[model samples]
Target: MSRRSILRIAAWPWLIASLAVLVIGFREAIFLTPADAAQGDIGRIFYYHVPSAMLSLVFPYVNFLASLAFLYWRRRDPLKALAADALALAAAEVAIVYTTVCLLTGMLWGRATWGIWWTWDYRLTAELLLWLLYVAYLAVRRYSATGQTQTIAAVLSIFAAIDVPINFMSIRWWRTQHPAPVFFGGPDSGMDKTMLPAFLWNFAGWALWGTFILIFRYVLERRRQAAEQEAALVAIEASLEISQ
Candidate 1:
């Protein structure tokens, strides 16, 4: 099969999987999952909130690797560089979307648990800062020129990756009630039996969904780059003809 044919075939499973996750998995998570004893009905938000927050933490690391690949491309392969930039951009965009959801859901979760819309807790504060960093990275890409945009984006993504672990660890290092890493506490923390399966299902679903989104975004970016390259070639030929 041609490359185009191969891509189309490969995308079929992702398409079906995405639809399944969206239609069946999402409803099951929201409606069927039992409420936490402590948090009550509001705990349903966990399906979206926890996944988005975790994804936000991870996506930047993907971007960081892609950015590095883009920056030091020894082969000077435009396609490789393009793939890296495209993936990085996709990861950043999805991370931003997921982060926004995370923040909103977190606030709602907090309101139920703490009776407040926001908190200055260490982990929350650091995550908020990380959100700002991704926003800045997007803005930098938008406002800067081609090569410069890539350079700055790479640097920002790398920096953002460094911040993720710090944000994750902040709650433990400082005194806070962010509920530790485990959802129902730790191994000895006594979790509700039913909740774990739902959480794990949703986590796997999000991982699959995130990959689909990044791949789709990468294809779009590649098309745009290809068009620009064609335009540049056309312009060069036009200038040469004019000189002749």
Candidate 2:
């Protein structure tokens, strides 16, 4: 099959699967899940909140790795460098989306649980810094000229990866107002039986959704690159014709 034909075939299945998972996950999260004894229905947000936070961290790491690949191959291999740059762009864009969602959901959850809209706590601060770093990364890609943008952004991405560990460990290492880890917080950390299933389902669903978005974005980036190359070729041919 032609590449376009293959993409068409693959796209529909991915869209359908993503929609099905998200819808089912939403239903389970909002209806099937029991309310937290302490937080009530407000706790339902955890289903989305946790998954977004998880993906926010995960995608940036993906970007970091892509950036490293770009840096290593950028001089020796143009095709590999282009591929890596495209992946880095895709991953960074998706990571920013997830991080935005994570921050917004976190603020909403905070209001519900802590009776405040925002705080400058350790984890929150670190996460905000992480978000800002990626925003800057995207800005450099979007606003800067093409020649040095990828290299500079790749270096920034490598530095930005440092925040991921700090954000993850903030709750454990510092006296923060944020809640303790539920998954790996030792014996004291556990979820209610009723909440666990919904949380897991939502987590899986969001993960799949994130993956789909990354793939879709990467495809779009590749198409854009192809168009640019075609346009450049046309411009070169026109210049040669005029010079003749």
TM-score of each: 0.91, 0.96
Off by over 4 Å in 1: 183-190
| Candidate 2: regions farther than 4 A off | 2-4
Top-scoring candidate (lDDT): 2
Best by TM-score: 2
Against the true structure, candidate 1 reaches a TM-score of 0.91
lDDT of 2 by residue, 24-139 (tens): 88888988887778888998889999999988999999999999999999889988888888999999999999999999999999998899999999999988999999999999
Q: Write the per-residue lDDT of candidate 1 for residues 1-244, one digit (tens) a residue.
A: 7875677788889878866765665666767777677777877777778878888888888888889998877259977888788888998998888788889989989888888998788888888988999999999989876757888888998878989989877865778756576543457553466776667677777878888888888888888989999999999999999999
